[model samples]
Target chain A: MPPVLQIIDLKDSQATRSYLTKQTLRSWLLTTDHKRVGLLYLYTIIVFFAVAASAAAVMRLNLLTPRGDLVQAETYNKLFTMHGVLMVWFFLIPSIPSVLGNFLLPLMLGARDLAFPKLNLLSWYIFVFGGGIALYALLIGGVDTGWTFYTPYSSTYSNSHVALMAAGVFVAGFSSILTGLNFIVTTHKLRAPGLTWFRLRLFVWSLYATSVILVLATPVLAMTLTLMALERIWKVGVFDPALGGDPLLFQHLFWFYSHPAVYIMILPGMGVVSELIAAFSRKRVFGYTFVAFSSLAIALLGFLVWGHHMFVSSQSVFAGVIFSFLSFLVAIPSAIKVFNWTATLYRGSISLDTPMLYAIGFIGLFTIGGMTGLFLATLAVDVHVHDTYFVIAHFHYIMVGGMVMAFMGGLHFWWPKISGRMYPELLGKMTAIVTFLGFNLTFFPQFILGYLGMPRRYHAYPEQFQVYNVLSTAGASILGLGYVLPLCYLIWSCCYGKPAGNNPWGAKGFEWETTSPPPSENFEKPPVQTEEAYAYPVPSSEPITE
Target chain B: MNARAILYEQFSDLEQQRESSLAGIWAFIASEIMFFGGLFLAFTVYRLNYTQAFNEASQHLNLVLATLNTAVLLTSALTMALAAASNKMGWKYSTLLLLMVTTLLGALFLAIKGIEYIEDWHKGLFPGSAFAWTGSDPGHVQLFFVLYFLMTGFHALHLMIGMGLILVMLLLTWKGWINSRHFMPLDVTSIYWHFVDLVWIFLFPLLYLLGAKI
Candidate 1:
């Protein structure tokens, strides 16, 4: 046999003693293991992603013609509401953090498990219970309040399952809180002996930033949802303008949690892209401290810019300008990240691996997303595009194009470690390309249509806009294909793919020090980090700017 | 040696375990602050908009009972602090006694709050359709009452959770699961108890005292 197959056989023999060795269902369901919890989250979120994507498919089909003949207008409202709610709370928000963060944090720290392993298990249970409640609301006539659940309509007017959906989201917010709390405590307390602050991976830093937002911001959302639900039930509660309460107060409170929520969704993806870029390029990340601090900057600055979303809601012009300016400030840290990633790739032994494809795609797409965000942040421009598809396209570029691409990249990058198997690389690269092409084809034209006076959430449009609608729906089909291909191949790889030895990609993180599908205890003995992160052996002329 | 038995498997030593638990609870409390902070913010906005009506509604609250309840909560905090201190000093029976006193004080505060709710109901101060307020601005007064009930009700909910946790600590102490050497549970619980008390400290002034200056 060749040397590679011999090594594969050696690694394959160890799989019997790994975390996957347990075949009993009870072990998985009641596991306090962070890796198992992460896998549980991975399975749960994938199901939610499929459900939300199906909702998007129906909506896209409905929008294929100038006149929406596929679903009724009310159904379309419900469709988008379900899509937005699931995609935001169920899928995107928890995608990277709960799954990858839960799996990797302990491994990277070389700890036995998360600080509170039982709490980690509880977070997953809360997530699933909350997901069940949200689905139940959908079954009993879905809510149409948009995921925003903007007031007056959600509180008084809309006659759908508003309170039930709010309750679902309210319960789910605790999961995010617990996960954030667990991560913060673990990062503070559980690092291996020599793993000081700067020596940690950028992913850990970004997650720490993300957790700070998650811990502080999610509770406000929980309370806001509770108040909204109470208002819907009481009819005389807060946010009812007729009752001398202000609807704008609801908007302020909701966005206070939500704008930070956007960071929660994408920051982990940025962390993931950071790791992928460094690992695949085989170089130290350029300006490590700057990149680490930029994550913190984005989290801190994310809070002050919530009011930008309120600029057109009769908010004071002075406040709008401040919010608009603060909104512009967020782009600086984001640009720092993009520039540093690009700089890391320069003069490095760059490999066009599957993960690198997604990372590069993220840099290009996130730049587009970040730049368009400034247009919306401008006070004068927002007046025209507020609540339009321009707003829709901008966020999708961030959430879908940016976050989702980074998620796929991280998943592929970490797949061998996660599943102890290698997915077919050609198919992985093809999915990345198709997803990038499909995402832009779907959303890019919507920006044009929005600028040309097409509003969002409308089932029917003017005949002049039908061509773009057609193009978007076509892109939706391709995007759906991109998502489905991974589900099939990744699952197939789990059972049939060739056994991948430890450190298949020659990655340098502490996680790569252990076996793929690491033992239930994570490491046989605790690891002490000695080298700085992404310290590629090839000497770079770049000075280590601490 | 007994404390060693209580250490979780994930931590390297007892000190790291205690440190993590403290950090974890503090993080939890920070989130709780934002939770209550949202309601406080809404109250601030509406109070500014309808100052007179909110003041009028605030005046109707039974200040005497609420003041009494405030004293009850403060005493509970003192006892809670003593309990934590006693646990650290390894005085098993005294710690249990102080914990019981703290839990009772919490119950007394809740009972007084229940009486105040009944009094408010008799005065038709509730926010629903039956709210019998003919004040300067009935709508705004109703809004004021809506916020008052929500804030105080949520605060009461948190106190109940704290009380339940205290009961668990009491049992653990009785079972000798929490001793001086392994007092992190009691320590963490006291922090939570004090946080609840502090929230009430803010609420008493915001809801009950805002109208006192007038």
Candidate 2:
């Protein structure tokens, strides 16, 4: 047998013993284990998925017959806003890094727990508390402020439970800040012996970059929201246009945090796709340091591009020009990542597994999504596309199409360890296929509809838009089935699926070197660093980096 | 024979774990700087935008109380830092005493802040309904006060939270949960306390010292 297989067999035998014990499960749930805390975050975000998806369902329902047939146009507006708010803050931004990054970061680096376990758990609770409040706010009528929570409308004009929903978003913002702080502190202080700066995983580097955005970007968001809430309650003139305040200032402040927030959403997806691509291709990622720094580069450049979102919204033309040029520059690092992933696949033994399929879906959709964004970035193009379904189609491609695809890829990639059993592979592939087809069906035609000058947030569109609406609504149904199928079987797999042997997929990482389900401690003894990340077939000599 | 011996022997890694937490808290304090740094960046940008409005709005603030609040917060930071340092120097009582003083001063800042707010309310300087600014283009001037209330209001909220935490530290110290040898509490508390001070260091210039005539 091969040397790597020998090691794999050894871990499988060990996992068999641990699986029979009750202590591991109890230790995971009640204890202050950072790994366990990460798992808890994973569990909570699925609930976010269920809630956010329902909001999307309502959005699709409203558009089915058009002309305000199914739900009132006002109901339609509320539906989309709720969908945007729940998904962006709750699911996409926090999903990969907070849940998976928190789970895998310390373990991959061989730390015992995070530098602060209590703080780790506290961040999770804060996240759940935030989600609960937002859910409740939605239950009691709804907040009419778009997820962006724009000024004058959010502050003074439209009163649809503004305080409750704003408060919910406020709490959620703190959770993002706290989690980012914990990850930064952990990466700084908690690496295992000899896990030097250069020797770290690309995923860890991406996570560190992400946390910086979270800590810095999220607080500004929190303060911005607080100012809005106060203006709503205290009737402050800070952003009230009638009171001589520039409501545009609120737009400037909001997109300041929000534009970087998209990076916060997508950077982790970028990180997850890195692991997925490398693992599936069975090769060391090309230009490793460049790929790592590119994550940091995207994060840095992301902050400079917020004004592009406001180009047609009365921002100074000089600011618009700066933001426009920077927007083009930001795409360079993202292109570098795509180039490296493609290079990793060159002359490699790539497989078509469930995770890899989703990874491929992420790449294709993310590219199309990214390309469409350039149209919105250009001054002339933006004038034509602004506030149109072209805008909606453009972002949903990146967010729902791109980020959500990577999110599922990650869920399946890490599930064997997270749950102590194997998910049915055939069933997994079906969902993956459905998700891809359904996603494309739903959003692709909307791009054309948008370019044809159909405005978004309209309950009754011109008869010309009906064809596109029919396509979108039809796609949503398949997408809904794609989403629901996994929830059923993945849960069923938890109790009765085949036992996942340790290292079910032949991979070379310390996480794979552990049990199928890790022990309560995650490692029996402190894992010593011995190999560089993503070096396939287990190199016998000359470990890369430090 | 003593609690120290038992703490070390029983857990076997208690001291190691506590030191890790102390390290963690200091790292968290660093993150806090960067977090507040973002707001400071925003303030810097807008301060550049409407300099006259910013200065005129600062004038509406009572400088006496602002100066007094600055002194009080600075003194509290000093006490809090000394509290952490004294624990390292093996002075448990001094550490506890400094913490107590820090708590007292934090409360004093809130008290002075409340009084200033009341004075502003009477002067019709609040941002919203019943705002008064004697100038041409009073609207942008009102924006300055809106920002003033927001920036200072946020700082005040952080102060209140810090006060609550310090109270918890006081009770722990009194309960003998804190000591010279096991002083992670003192260290973490000091980092937070100093952060509150640093916030004021920026707030002092931005809110009170900027655009002052005398």
Give the alpha carbon lDDT tens digit for every residue of A381-499 in model 2: 89899999999998999988888888888888888877767788888888999999999999999999999999988778777678888899899999999888888888998878787
Model 2 clashing residue pairs (backbone): none
> What is the Cα-based lDDT of residue A283 in candidate 2?
80
**TM-score, candidate 2, chain B alone:** 0.86
Off by over 4 Å in 1: A1-8, A540-546, B1-5
Residue pairs with backbone overlap in model 1: none
Task: State the C-alpha lDDT per candidate.
Answer: 0.93, 0.79
Model 2 docking category: acceptable
| lDDT, model 1, position A332 | 96
- Model 2 error, position A90 (Å): 1.4
User: Residue A147 in model 1: shift from native, Å?
Assistant: 0.8
lDDT at A377 for candidate 1? Answer: 96
Give one digit per residue, the lDDT tens place, for model 1 in B81-157: 99999988888899999999999999999999999999899899987877897657888998888889999999999
Best of the candidates, lDDT: 1
Prediction 1 TM-score vs. true:
0.98
